[model samples]
Target: MSESTGGTGEGTRAVRAGLPEPVKNEPTLPGPVFAAHFHLPGDVEGPYTYGRDENPTWTLLERAVSELEAPGRDDVQTL
Candidate 1:
């Protein structure tokens, strides 16, 4: 239960859970990214190189799930 959703109804909490803060020119929920490979310059030292290995979509999902499961705890990690 996030601080925002604390003491709120389950439906409300579920709907509000894991939502990112509002940005000026961004959607409330980002669209999915579907790329098998990313462009890497020089050595492969960037965050994403292989889709199967890591993805921004999954990262956001994990964060959301973690927040739902363990709110206010940065030590929690979801997969």
Candidate 2:
């Protein structure tokens, strides 16, 4: 959400959004990406129900991508 989002280009957004964070209730810093499946109880409810729904895998992938690409101007040691 920005006042100038209307005219911003893809590259602008890519550089402006900064970077994403890792999500999980575990001690893992960066995890693996898996198309997981889930099962729920009839007397219970769950946020995710399918592999494509949402899982730790997607979160791990997102964080990995962000971290791998999150290099500041000075981070470029050479080239």
Candidate 3:
């Protein structure tokens, strides 16, 4: 077990990290999005153009790691 911080245990924090706020009909934890390619009309104007480059699953994992490592600091960047 790891140390606790901000009155929350490491295990607890890890479990709750990166979780978005509750929605009326949305699941508490969203399922992973698996895709090799996304629709691109003309040019790649959006963040997610390729699966290997970027995806919702990676974004969520990054958020979770960032939260666990830096808590309330939004300036923290996770790779």
Q: Highest TM-score, which number? A: 3
Model 2 alpha-carbon miss at residue 62, Å: 0.7
Which ranking of candidates, highest TM-score first? 3, 1, 2
State each candidate's clash count: 0, 0, 0
The lDDT per prediction is: 0.70, 0.46, 0.78
User: What is the per-residue lDDT of model 3 for residues 1-79, given as tens digits with 9 covering 90 to 100?
Assistant: 7667667778888887887866988788888665677574687576676667678878788889999888888778889
Colliding residue pairs in candidate 3:
none
- Model 3, poorest ten-residue lDDT window? 32-41
Over 1-79, each residue of candidate 1 has an lDDT whose tens digit, in order, gives: 3345446665665666676866998887777776677564675676666567677877777777887788678689777
Which tens-of-lDDT digit does each residue in 1-79 have in candidate 2?
Answer: 4433347665654554433443576543343443446454673465544477456655444544453365333232221
Off by over 4 Å in 3: 1-8, 38-47
lDDT of 2 at 30: 41
lDDT ranking of the models: 3, 1, 2
Q: In candidate 1, residue 60 scores what lDDT?
A: 72
Q: Clashing pairs in model 2?
A: none
